[model samples]
Target: MTDDARELADDVQELAEAQRQHWQNTYTTHPGMYGEKPSSPAVHAALVFRAAGAKDVLELGAGHGRDSLYFAREGFTAQATDFRPVGLKQLRRAAQEQGVAARLSTVVHDVRDPLSLPDASVDAAFAHMLLCMALSTKDVQALAAEVRRVLRPGGTLVYTVRHTGDAHYGAGTAHGDDIYEHGGFAVHFFPRHLVDSLADGWTLNQVHAFEEGDLPRRLWGVTQSLPQ
Candidate 1:
């Protein structure tokens, strides 16, 4: 990675720590926070699961199990993993309310850590806004390698992240690690190419961009096929 990319990745790690604190606060006060609605990536993953005949799905950064519930409702065995206990507790409750709790497994696993799964165990894995959460290139690479290691040959990997070129970071200004409090902690926006490089050997299947009625959106979705 270039110096700029390395610097950005460091910012992302701090941002992740901040984000964890923010969510911990959010779910502590409101168990149902972020439990009802799925983001664009979650919705997109749901559609893909439905269309692709997915039987087993893994959600890496399942915030509140929204997508996991969606997958379980659609007849797929879904496992939701996140490092936050509070969030995962809410996610478990949310899944119960959605009537998929029995089928959904909530695991308190950090993505940067070694994935505790057998080789080629799952049919698909999806991580929404996960790649950008790493603090450095090594973290990202480890997460990517885990993603690759646990996925079955020909399994699908789908995810989404914020685009750096978007105006959210302000136009004509360089992006830096200076923190700004949003929901209590600082956040980092990632460039597109850096995000794409997270998937070491996966074949890029599709890249799509979408927005919700023009609310200064900057998200891109990527679909890739894991190496067999």
Candidate 2:
């Protein structure tokens, strides 16, 4: 690459790192950001697991454990991990309050770093709205690898991510950049091609793009059953 291109790439990386730090600070200051209850996607994902006979599930970037709580309520053994300490604390409290202690475990983990789970340790893995906001292509790829590493062979990966062509860009999101600053932090956006590219080794069983009402949000999901 030319020196000019390299310089621009460095600038973008620095901006993305700033944005990531901002989000970490936000969750640290306000654990309630994930909401008092889980969202519809979380509930829907939980039901899918129950029907699939998946008893052991691991959720990556389990902010505040909203979906984890839902999974626990449904009698699934759910383990969730996030990088933020405050969010995990709130999640633990919420689980105890919701009577899901028997089915839930929370771990402090950063997917960008090395993962500590043994291979094929989980029956299924879920990533909800976590694919976006990656700092770079490498971070995006690492997130996928982490999910693949933790799942049992033939395990299911249920992922929901924001669509790149959705109308929400530039209003509160960065546009034309690999990553953008939002609410004091940087967020990465992935076009469909990039999302699929991250799934390089995983068997792509299905890919669906859906929108609800006038929410101006699009979800691009891929369902993959891990290879044996």
| Leading candidate by TM-score | 2
Q: Each model's RMSD to truth, in Å? A: 3.7, 2.9
lDDT of each: 0.72, 0.73
Model 2 segments more than 4 A misplaced: 1-17, 170-177, 212-215
Using alpha carbons, what is the TM-score of model 2? Answer: 0.83
- The residue ranges of model 1 lying beyond 4 angstroms of the native Cα positions read 1-15, 170-185, 212-214
- For model 1, how does the per-residue alpha-carbon lDDT over 1-228 read when each residue is reduced to its tens digit? 999877776766656676677767777888766547666687787777666656899998887677777778878899999888987887787777778877899889877679889988988888876665533556666777788888888888898765655455533332354223332434345566665686557788888886543656566788888765
| TM-score list, all predictions | 0.81, 0.83
* Number of clashing residue pairs, candidate 2: 2
Window of ten residues with lowest summed lDDT in model 2: 173-182
True lDDT of residue 47, candidate 2: 65
